[model samples]
Target: MRFCSRWVVRDQWHEVCLYEDYFLYRTRAADSTAPPEEHRVENGDIADIGVDREGPLWGITLTVTSGESRTVPCPATIAAPLLLRWHDRD
Candidate 1:
């Protein structure tokens, strides 16, 4: 599976991270060959997570802040009626 991600900074494109399985395949930024920022999530990191699923659509919350979050709707290529639960913080 391939996913496209765009990071915007100051109203401009900042960086992009491509994930293939559990590894990052490619990371690009506006002016540097390296990623704009490095994020290290712990082995069991779960913060501000939410889930949404309707009919044949499966959506997952990617980022959340102050109780507001963004959901990325997965295509039907992904299994439907899936359940996504937020892991409790340890």
Candidate 2:
């Protein structure tokens, strides 16, 4: 699943995606003059996952074992299932 937010004033788009085995985050700005920044983290390397409610969107934060952290915006439907599934594996 994927979700995006736009920063109009900065002309930037921020996005996050969760796949079966990885998480992806991306951002694009300035009319794509430069390449969009992307980050990927494997499921096995994720140390922790968390959620916070902000209206209808959930802020899903992933912390990696190597110390990088990212917060991805997602809906409740995707957030809860991901949390459950990840913990179940461990």
lDDT of each: 0.36, 0.69
TM-score of model 2 relative to the true fold? 0.56
Tens digits of per-residue lDDT, candidate 2, 1-90, equal 433333322465655556677767677775776777988888788888889977766777889999878775666666777677656653
Off by more than 4 A, model 1: 1-46, 65-68, 75-90
Global CA lDDT of candidate 2, please?
Answer: 0.69
The C-alpha TM-scores of every prediction are 0.30, 0.56
Per model, state how many residue pairs clash.
0, 0
Question: Which tens-of-lDDT digit does each residue in 1-90 have in candidate 1?
Answer: 133444433333332232332212122345665544444222233244345667654454544233444454443333222221123212
The TM-score measured for candidate 1 stands at: 0.30
Residue pairs in candidate 2 whose N, alpha carbon or C atoms collide under 3 angstroms: none
Predicted candidate 1, C-alpha RMSD: 8.5
> Can you give the lDDT of residue 56 in candidate 2?
62
